[model samples]
Target: MDICHEAPVKCLAYSPDGKWLATGSEDCTIILWDSEGQLVQEWVAHAGEVWSIAFSPDSRHLASVGFRREHAVWNVMPGQGAPKAMILEGHTGLVVSCAWSPDGTLIAAGSGDKTVLLWDARTFQLLHRLNLFTLEQHAHAVTHITFSSDGIRILSASSDGTVKIWDAFSGALILSLEGHTCGVNKACFSPCGKYIASASSDQTVWLWSIDDGSCVETLFEHRADVRHVAFSPDGMTLSSGACDGTVAIRHIRDIILVQDTDM
Candidate 1:
């Protein structure tokens, strides 16, 4: 479990097929390991800290974002030595997060410049620049973003104490879920795409309903800022990590029962 990197590992991702694991580090390198934990390949991926990594749905491509305001797409195939396919450059600030659409048609990146940029994955062309600078949008850096299971919607977390849902194709704002008292650090869509879970500097994770943008539950217990949140493959269990060096796992059924009891 201890795959050491030269510097702090900022992000980790597994290929959709579960054959390869990729880790990005503050040393500006990306390392690939096979399922057996054998090092497959290593490459200098960026000039600054690699902030995020994600694999295409088909497991053929890997996308990475860095603090250097650029993101790169790499071909991930056996015997292919981490060849860079394209570099996406549009953000004026650090590119903090990246995710590929479910069908592998689009890639979305969040940046410190208060915008989310969408790209055509096939052609590596800029498709849309979603601005979060207005009164209706996030007022600070976008820290994390995820696409819905159907790829029609995007959920973004920001330093502005809010999570916003957007129409992925049209770049139109959908809904903003605000309840956290501090900046949101990470957000993820449930496997069923019916809910969004967000971690915040407020030391809590808020579970929001996608239909009504309502905060259904606020999970607390972490003694420090929550850094990440994810749902199990079955969407029944939720896991969270925090700066307190603790991880918590809760079952969705238990959360529902708690909600019902409160009601």
Candidate 2:
């Protein structure tokens, strides 16, 4: 199943309902596909490369951001020529990553401006501007942001080699997980909200305790910069992708066994 686009595909997301797939490309366009891989709709989404895309929890809308300083949310309901999208303006730097809150009320985005902005998903209004530098104060760009499964916390990765946890409602910095030797590229929360997994340019994936902000284990299988990390919906497995063009999936049980033996 090879779905081709005119330019490099930078990011993609699946609708929460599992009915649609949206792909963002360097061609400045977004194409929606059905489960059968049929193109449902295509539209120019941004002026530059589309860096990231995320679907609302209800699967009614898709949010995207990119090299363009702004982000957009599209009503991607089926049966449309060009979906109606609203542009969100405010970020001064390229928007790099985005995620919808578990409850679907908010969308959080990280940018090269070194800040994270929370938006009202319904009204497309800015709710909070979290300046990482002004808060916990980081020296580099915020690369990624995601909400905890319980929707109570926000996890962010930065080019400064640290992952920061924030109180989702207060927009207050909670804890800084500092262990990566280089920039942290991505971070994700376990499905049960008990742990955080982070991928780093240091070529490793780190599992950290959400309870105490302690590094649980550093998995060093990736031969190059690790770009992404994700936990299975069941929270029993972890997967990572790297610049070395490889993806590794590890069972959480195995990780726990290794940790116990090392202790």
Candidate 3:
């Protein structure tokens, strides 16, 4: 589709209601598009390449992190003079990714600084800091972190090749799973919070039993680096993306192919 102004897309996010999409680009801007893929709003979304973007669960706001650690939350509707919101900054290194907690009260962000920072969505105040190294396990940058469906636990992936689970509110790491031969790019909790799926540059995806820190399964069909993964909202299927230029959909339990589409 003919998307927007001259720029290569870097990342994309869909609103919670699935009514709109936001595309971040190398153009240092983000284009807002309606569900039909028509442009609704476009503006300077970042000072540098916008790396990641997410819409608030309420669908009233948008959030982005890019251009070397700069993070911002914006009002979603068309606006003018002053920015719809304020800029957020605290990480010592590049801000890698951020997501809203299931409860919608906290925003959790992972950083190149090797930490996950939690902030109050309304006050923009730091609420908690989850230091990866403090656990005496991870020795590299934290790439991504997501909350469990219960909103009481956080699962994070790091360049140190491990995925760690922590108490969401107290910032206490509960378990560290070390299996990937290479760095872990991402770790995500299933919609039901019963499992955690991890993607690694080691060419495999590991499904872990979140309740006991046991690996339930491993999928290695990609034959290349696996970068990201997510469970379908219903928990019936899983989708994964890789450097192999493929997106595969598989049955969540048996890893059977429901659909495999190359993108």
Q: Who wins the lDDT comparison?
A: 1
Ranking by lDDT: 1, 2, 3
Of 1 and 3, the candidate ranking higher by TM-score:
1
Model 2, C-alpha of 172: deviation from truth (Å): 7.4
Evaluate all candidate structures by whole-model CA lDDT and list the values in order: 0.79, 0.78, 0.73
Question: In candidate 2, what residue range of length 10 has the lowest lDDT sum?
Answer: 240-249
lDDT, candidate 1, 1-263, per-residue tens: 23556665566666767677677777788888886667898988888878888889898889998876869999987685556658998899878788887788999887878888999999999999998633347898677777687769878789999999988788889999989999998898877677788988999989988878888888886777877677755666676656544556677877655654765
Candidate 3 RMSD to the correct structure: 6.2
Q: Ten residues in a row with the worst lDDT in model 3?
A: 254-263
Error of 3 at 174 (Å): 3.5
Q: Give candidate 3's error at residue 165 in angstroms.
A: 2.0
lDDT of 3 by residue, 1-263 (tens): 23344554545556767566676766788777775667788889788977777778888788888877889998887544433656886899988787887667888777877787889998989889887644435798676766676668777789899999888777887998888889997788766666788888898988877667777788876766776676655566655556544545566644322211210
How displaced is residue 263 in candidate 3, in Å?
Answer: 35
Which residue pairs overlap in candidate 3's backbone? none
Flag clash pairs in model 2. Answer: none
Ranking by TM-score: 2, 1, 3
